[model samples]
Target: MSVNVIILNGVSSSGKTTLAKAIQKYSHEIWLHVAMDSFIAMLPDGREFDREWFPMVEVSREGEVLPQMTNGPSGEALLLEMRRLVRGLSETGFNVIVDEVAEADTIADYRGRLGNGCLVVKVDAPLSELERRERERGDRLIGLAREQSERVHNGISYDLEVDTHAQTPDALARLILERIAA
Candidate 1:
């Protein structure tokens, strides 16, 4: 049997990781979870503010301040490489679940690069719920959900849209499995 790829896209704290973990735990196939956060974490710290490296800027919207990470040249290259790595893994017969924030261009890139056999899933939660989750998590920068919620799914379409606020991760994973099985 050929390997399959599932791309879980959503804003910060929207439960993509949770759903990915649930899928890995419940699915008979051993799915490798490739998270953007883990790849980003691999980058050296203290460069997030450097324009030539990974520049993150603070922007205010509706009286709330948010940190927006700019995909500068370096960041863009890293993202492309990450996408390629995921594709390569899948080509090598490894099932892959990619958890990422779906920026418009990034979605397009994945669509073009991965082509068929890729199931794009939108893991969603209301902006208010996302903000609450972000706060509760406390590991993320303040207002990241707000910033990402505004832009992450722009111009992206999905085979499945799961609402984390309404569904538990395990339930969502089952739904995803059913969809893939059909």
Candidate 2:
């Protein structure tokens, strides 16, 4: 049987991963969470040291702030790699939940590569709520908020759109399940 691929896409701190995990926990579907952040984090030393992927961040150590590496690879490259993984997983009969900031073009490209059975869900929240979540998540976004807003408007349309600002994970998961069933 072919897997039901779901792309839980949204701006940063939109709770994509949280909701994706909830669906995986509640549903009987054989699913995999292909997190871009974890993918970037696991690169080998040679690739990890490359300036193109691993950028330096000024991190706090005691009273001092020092540079550290964060956000490996450009967003485009990361999304492409994620599409490749999704295609592989779907071919192997595993439903894939991709929690990434995939652009409209990337989504279109991936849809072609993964075939028509894929479901794209756009998880969104109020900008203010998203900002608070971002702060709470401890991912120093810097200028990403502005970029996220712009991309959300421009990104490809989704099969489902959920405003997760006030709903619990279970509620959101139910919404997703209902859509998938429909």
Candidate 3:
């Protein structure tokens, strides 16, 4: 059987990783959870925080602080390499679940590469709830959810939409499995 890839796109603390893990745990199919965060975490020391390499800025609006990442050439190259890695895994018949916060251009880039067997899912949560989750997680950079709230889903539609605030991760994973089976 040909492998299927489910791409979960959302902002920080939107539960994409949680849902991806839930899907892998509960689903009968052996699914590889491939997260862009993992690829980003693999970046050489200091590269992720270096402005010359990654080019991030902090902006404050209405007392809310947020970070803006401008992925310069180096960052873009890494993203492309990560996308290709996901593609290669799927092409080799590994069912993959990708967790990413992708804007329109990045989504388009993946669409062109992954082609027919890929399903794009929009993982959503309200900004308020996302902010709360980010705070609770403690590991995420503060304001990341707010920074991405408006841009992550811009100009994109999905094969499935799941709101983390509305359902449990297992419930959402089950729903995705049903959709895939259909």
Candidate 4:
């Protein structure tokens, strides 16, 4: 089946965003990149502790700082609209690339939102590599990768699975292209 949307599902810091950009850069067809973070960024004033915004990170008894951001109302509304936007874009015949941290609920939601014309790709890396990347980036919550690494793919299935720990985004994108073309 032909698809207009590609969803890259993975934990934070797994390079889904980089892969999406690489796919856009190299693809013969132009695609619009829609990232879940783009909606998160729309939260007013970037509030973290509002409990209506991102609600801040949680700490475990073992001193693990986990940023398990379950969106409060405002964030939820934004995400809902983002999914709708993706659906609308694909319906309009635009090729779309989605960079997402797919938890169980959103995976199911995306299936309904993106319709039949979508490809879900599992983007992943080892937890160690993910943590390293997160620390190297220094812009994300310290434990987001650790927190999400275990849960992102729990209930989701994908058309392709790619590991990014030892590869560049461009190479990975080429692999995805070749596999899909097959």
Among the numbered candidates, top TM-score falls to 1
**Pairs with backbone N, CA or C atoms under 3 Å apart (clashes), candidate 3:** none
TM-score to native of every candidate shown: 0.93, 0.78, 0.92, 0.91
> 22-46, model 1: which lDDT tens digit per residue?
9998899999999988877877786
**Cα lDDT, model 4, residue 98:** 89
- The per-prediction CA RMSD against the true structure, in angstroms, equals 1.7, 6.1, 1.9, 1.9
Q: Which ten residues in a row have the lowest lDDT in candidate 1?
A: 45-54
The clash tally of candidate 3 reads 0
Candidate 4, superposed: residue stretches over 4 Å from native: 59-65
Ranked by lDDT, the better of candidates 1 and 4 is 1
**Sorted by lDDT, highest first, which candidate order results?**
3, 1, 4, 2
Runs off by more than 4 Å, candidate 2: 1-3, 44-51, 54-78, 153-155
Clashing pairs in 2: 53-73, 57-68
Candidate 1 TM-score versus the reference: 0.93
- The 10-residue segment of model 4 with minimum total lDDT is 56-65
Each model's backbone clash number:
0, 2, 0, 0
lDDT of each: 0.85, 0.73, 0.86, 0.83
